[model samples]
Every structure is written in C-alpha cells, then in structure tokens.
Target: MSHHSIEARDLAFSYPDGTVALDGVSFEITHGESVAIVGANGAGKSTLLMHLNGFLTPLRGSVRVGDVPVIKSTLSDIRKAIGTVFQDPDDQLFMPSVYEDVAFGPMNLGLPLEEVDARVIEALTQVDALRLKDRPPYRLSGGEKRAVAIATVLAMRPNALILDEPSSNLDPRARRRLIGLLGTFTHTKIIATHDLDLAMDLCERTIVMSGGTISADGRTGDIFTDDALLDSCGLERPLSMQNCPKCGRSD
Candidate 1:
C-alpha cells in the first residue's frame, strides 16, 4: 500500500518568534510500519508530527501522505486517511457520551447513521471498550479516556494513526493496557513519545531527533542500547533494558 506511506523531504520550520523547530529534516515511513519518534522536550518530535497531517505547514520542504501532498487543498482528503490522537484525550473527546465522541468523525464525514453506528461498535469493540459506550468522557478513568480517545480515531477508519504521547499520564496498568491496544492495530503508526519502553515494545524502527534534526535512525534495539548516544540525546536505557540495582549497569 504505497498510497499509505508517508514521506517528508528537507523539512524546515521556524516559529513566529524565530525559534527553529525543525531544520532540513526528512524521512520516509512505509505502509504498515510502526515507527517511534523520540527526543528531549524541545527536540522537535511534535513539530515533525504536526507536519504529517497538515496540522502545520513547512516553511521549506514538503510532506506527502502516499501520493497526496500535505497541503491546504489536500487537507480534507489527507485527514480522512490520517487520524491523529492528541496527547490529551480531553482534546479529542468533547461529546456528552462515549458513543457520540466515537461517532463524531464518521458523522462529520456525512456517513449514513447505520454506517456510523457500525463504525462506533467496531471501534469500541476493538479497544474492548463497548461497556463504556454510555459513560461521559469526563467521568472516565485516565485509562478509559485513553482507550476512548483511540477509539474515536479508529472510528474514522483511517489507514494511519498519529499519536502524540499516547502513554502519557496513565498509571502502570493503564499504560500497559494502552500498549496492548496499540499493538493490535494494523495501521501505520507514527508515535511521538518519551516512553522508550513503549517504543521498544511497539516499534521495530526509531528516529531520534535533536535540535530539530534527526541524530539517529535505526532499529529500535541498536538505537536504545547505545548509552552514549541516548545520553547525548537526553535519554537513558529503558527500564527493561537496564541492569538491576544489585546487578550494576549493563553494557
């Protein structure tokens, strides 16, 4: 599915105040690939993702979702192919009930009521959240909100998923649940997160960004094992890869 692949060419962007967020960054993510974008707080991980679905336009360079350019004229169609789940579930879930929130996207697409209903059921079922369909978003536990937020995106049936900090703010069980949920998606996934363990679990490939540019891009294991490299990027080995307190640090 070449049409589902994403590519960025020489991407460069600067904020209004003249802060360079990305500088000549470029990469390609093939269809069905789950890729992790990792970096420090201001490393430009978020900025790079914003350009994928036309949430932000590049000052110089181009991004293409398959054959479609991520430009103003193609935004509507592009959005239909890419569903983004923001870091905060509250940002995506605003309807009174879980059902409405899941149905919102397909409904906006002018789908028939029957089709929308089918989609909501399928999405909620996928997340194993059918039981919470009637609950208010605000009333949900952090994990519940995360599941529903993802369901809202799944309901749209996009070929790719863009998640910004999908594991953020969740308790251990909630985070593990989120990881399991995401592991089941066949769609192309581009996740921006500080959750190195999640990256290790879900992605085969990883891109490390620094100062608005990529410092490393390779298999997740190779990238994560390089202590000096990760340390330079303001990160450390994931807990799973670390030595135990009595074992001392592993090489």
Candidate 2:
C-alpha cells in the first residue's frame, strides 16, 4: 500500500468559459495526517477537493488516492475511499429523512442491508445526530443539517475525509462540537476553509492556496505567524488571543 493518502501531480483545470481554477498544483497528503487548505474566495480550494474524489477531472496531470488513480475508469473506487463533504450542507443532503440521507452512500456501495443500517446508526451517533435520524432534513437547523451531511459521508467509512468549509455557517457551540467530533476520527483528513481559528485548532499542517496554486505548505503554527504571507493571500493572521489545542501552546 502507498504511504501517501492523496497525491496530486502537476494538476491543472479550466472552466468552459476559459477561467482557470487550478494551475499545475502538486502536493501529497500523508496517511493519518490532519491538513487544512486555506485560501481566499476563488482560490481553488473547492476545485482541489473535487479532484480528490474524481468529481472534477483535471484538464492536465492526475490525482491519486492511495494506489488508485482518479481516472474515469477508477472514479467509483476512488470515491469509495475518499468521502467529500461540500461547503453547503444542502448540496450534500437531499433525502427526506436524516437516516436515509446518511444511508445513501453505503447503499450505493451495495453493502448488505443490515450492514448499511448499522453503519447509518453509527454515523448518526458519530455526529451526535442519532436522535434526529427520522426527522425531515429540511426541518433541521443549520448545524444539525451540516452534521447530517457529514454523517452521510462518514457512513461509508472512507479512508480519507475531505471536508470543504466544514465549519461554515455554524455557531460557536456547533463549531466546537464539530471539531470535537472530527478529533475522534483517525483517517487522513483534508479540510478546505477560511476559518483559520478552526484550522489552528484541528490541523497540524496548513497549505496556503492562492491564484490556483499552493503558495505555502508548513506547520500550522509557522504559517499563521507570518503576517505578510497571510496578508498576501487575503487572510488575516489567526488572532493572538486564541488558544490552539493541537499545539498545546496559546498565543
């Protein structure tokens, strides 16, 4: 088995309108590592996550999850290994009931019915949404809906968890809960978000994206301390008053 969980080599993509999203981006995420991709709006963060799961094919180069390449012939297999959660919960959760939404991926994978049921229950429990399993997805609060969306992907037990703006639109309490839940998972985690506070708390490493390419990749503490670099990327330095649990050091 390969040591790297995800590898992108000289990847590039352009939209139908000739707008470039990713420009020869290359990086590798190691197994069991927690990484945050930080960038301003339209920095190609979401575009990169799409390539990780084969949702968007690169106009050039390639993306690989473990030993499997994210090509058309292997897209399904690659998706099974990497569960991607979009920034908006509504984009991911469309089923009527929470249970059904969480069960969708497992069912699509053709797991046995009983196994799927068990996975659904486990996933809901993971996100502390077991009590809302039968509730209508539309009725849940923003935080609740986001939890369900995460549960939907977790039910498949993907090898790597790729979350885009996982803490977006969440209240402080909800954000704390989400972070706690993420801390329990041991899989390789890649999160793309502008929430530098959350990234400092959760990720050991941070990759800075700008103009469709990675501008910096290093320890989270090192990246956050550089004011000039943060300014260049249109990101503010993480507040000096905040405490980061992962580093066991507070500013």
Candidate 3:
C-alpha cells in the first residue's frame, strides 16, 4: 500500500480585516517524520499548522492528509487522523475532569463505551496523567494540563500530531519531561515552536517561515547552523549549536 502523508500546496490565507497570514506556502512531510516549523511571531506558523487538520480553509490552495483533501466532507476524518494540541492548555482542557477531557475525542468518534474506556486509560497512561484522571483540569499544574490536553488527542490514535508552541511556559523539568514523552511517539509529528532547543531535540527536519512565506527548509543541523538564515527569520542558533566544542561560538 502506498502511504502518503501531510501535504500542502500553494496555501494562502487572510484575516477578516485583510491581514495575510499565509502566502504561497507548500511542504510535504513523510509518514513518521518529525518536522519543526520555526518562525517569529506573526510569521504564519500557527496558521499553517491549522491547515493540516482542516481547522482553517485555505483561500487559494489545497491541503491533504493521507490523500484526503481537507474539505468539509473529510474534515471529521482528517481531524481524527491528524490531532492538534493548542499552545494554551486551557484551550483544549475544557472538560471538568482529565478523564472526561481525554475521553472526549474517542467518544465523539462514536466508539463503544468499552473502547472509549480503554483508549482513555491508554492515552492517560502514555502521558503519565493516569493519576490525575479524576482531578479537575483546572486543579492540575500547567504541565499536567498540557499532558492531559495531549491525551485528549492521543485517545483518537491520530496518524499525525500537530503541536503549536508546546514548550511555552514550562519549567525546565516539565519541559524535559515533555520532550521525553514526545520522543516516544512513532507517529508523524509537526511541532510549530519558537523553542529552538526543543526543535533541535525532537525534529530532524526544520522549516523556516517568514512574512507568510517559506524562507528555508532543510535538515535541522544545517538550518540551525546557518546564522544568516536564522537571523533573517528572526531566530537564533540553537543553544546546543552555540555551545558546541566544534563550532566554538559563544555569546
């Protein structure tokens, strides 16, 4: 069987007030690939990520998830196949309890009660949030809420995971723990983040966006090493690169 993954071609979008968010952006991620979308604020990274799951329709192009175009007919299935975790945990953790929040996706998919229960348990266990399953989402720490938000999507067993600014507002320990958890997922991952360290730790490929356009796309190592390109995109070299013995560069 031929397995196609996420593909976007000539995508363009604009805000209600005529602010262009994405312009002629195109990229393809193979199945199981981990890619990072890096850009400064208002660089259109979030808008592009939204396209992957059909949350926002493109004004002048197309997007496909596993050969299914992101149209109204395929929106539900597409969303199921490509799960998204918002930058803010509160945006996704709306259900009263962690268990309910985690179960929401599978339940909405019309799975049987037993299957939903199993999925809830499995997802929570994967994120190490099983102990907090009964607790209200608001009561948990920021990291805990982030984990539970991820669990909500995992319960659906999506083929691809999309996360926006996932490392924002996390302490060092919590951030490291999240990196470890995300490392274990075999599914394709597309993380849009300003956290270059997280990008270096997780993604093999890096895509750089600027002014609603793709300015660079290549191996993570090369992209991070190109100081001029990073500078152009309002990014800096990954700390690991800067502190490398071989590169011999410092602040």
Cα lDDT listed for each candidate: 0.94, 0.90, 0.92
Worst 10 residues of 2 by lDDT: 237-246
TM-score for each of the candidates: 0.97, 0.93, 0.96
Q: Over the stretch 1-251, how does candidate 3's per-residue lDDT look in tens digits?
A: 13659899999999999999999999999999999999999999999998888889999999988777899998888887888999999999999999988988898999999999999999999999899999999999999988989999999998889999999999999999999999999989999999999999999999999999999999999999999999988999887768656766564
Candidate 3 accuracy as TM-score: 0.96
Best by lDDT: 1
Model 1: what TM-score?
0.97
User: Each prediction's Cα RMSD?
Assistant: 1.3, 3.6, 2.2
Model 1 / residue 127 / CA error / Å? 0.5
**Local error of candidate 3 at 209, Å?**
0.2
Judging by TM-score, tell me the better candidate of 2 and 3: 3
Q: What is the alpha-carbon lDDT for the whole of candidate 3?
A: 0.92
| Best prediction by TM-score | 1
Clashing pairs in 3: none
Model 1 Cα lDDT, one tens digit per residue, 44-97: 999998999898999999999999889999999999999999998998899999
